[model samples]
Target: METLFDSACRYMSDSELIYEITNNKKLVTEAERQGGEYDLNGLFSSLTPGRKKVATAAIELYKRLQSRHNGQDAIRCSQDIDALIHPFLWDLPNEELWVIALNTAAKVIKKVRVSVGGISRTAVDVRLIMRILVEASATQFAVVHNHPSGSKHPSREDENVTERLKKAGTLFDICMIDHIIIAGDTYYSFADEGRL
Candidate 1:
């Protein structure tokens, strides 16, 4: 039976095929030496241009499929919000603020990354957030950001931002449902704690 690599080798140039075989051998050796941990980035970076394009396209396809799968459910709780936003924000080395615009039934309309900041904090523009909600015609929304430091506690800045969003949402008759802080595997929810 032909192996997957054998099948792949049929499509590669002679030089590319040799490089892949050599790289795989080196990666297997390194994995064994490192107790089964291998450099995935190294493996990806070593792929031929065509293979890299295919890999990237495959990844984007997976994300779209996963998003569509998750988007069908109405967000009923903070955990739901966490689940939706975690894949985007969690494990980031820096901070990014995102807003999830929700329809009347709490299904997601759109999720937009509003800002990217340093390791500790990110600034959010309430006007921009509102504009996105308006554009989506969302009646409810949530704010999400990650704490790279792994602190689930909301900072004073977090509190202030939440209050500002809440007030602004009121003005437009759009409800601010939750503000979530993703810290590693844990999370903080303003609505869960009666802070929203």
Candidate 2:
């Protein structure tokens, strides 16, 4: 026989719903959500009861995950990326959308690009990125591309895209972690470097 707790979890996961139980056991709905069960108890156990604020913790943890990353799944650590590009030095320039998908742990679930092409600036439709991130069901995302000019660099264009996407993420409640620029093996993190 299925237990009531199991049924509740199942229903919550399938419907992307979370139920908050009060001290008196009154159930309150927080927000609409997707993905499977989150270890809410385990994640929160370390916090003192007086400070265990579920909603606040979830948002902050999401930010912290993107703030500290190896860039291995999302980016590699060996290269700074900014030091690698030399668009003026090369005849053929290419662009790529670097991405990282994360779970509740703030650990990467996967990394991917939505598009890659010329000039690093030509594409990057902010609207398009919204769909791609949602399709992956990512709760957070980082956008990145190379300058090809070896600058470990971000341009005026880059800043604009980052801002637009950040606002979009906020609107959707999807955490916009950070943006990165990769050239060769080098990487620059927008959040860590404080550019974003």
Across residues 95-154, which tens digit of lDDT does each residue of candidate 2 receive? Answer: 777556555445555555577677655577777787777777778766667656666677
Q: Which window of ten consecutive residues has the lowest lDDT sum in model 2? A: 22-31
Runs in model 2 lying further than 4 Å from the true structure: 1-93
Q: Return the top candidate by TM-score.
A: 1
Cα lDDT, all candidates:
0.86, 0.57
TM-score against native, each model: 0.77, 0.50
Q: What is the Cα-based TM-score of model 2?
A: 0.50
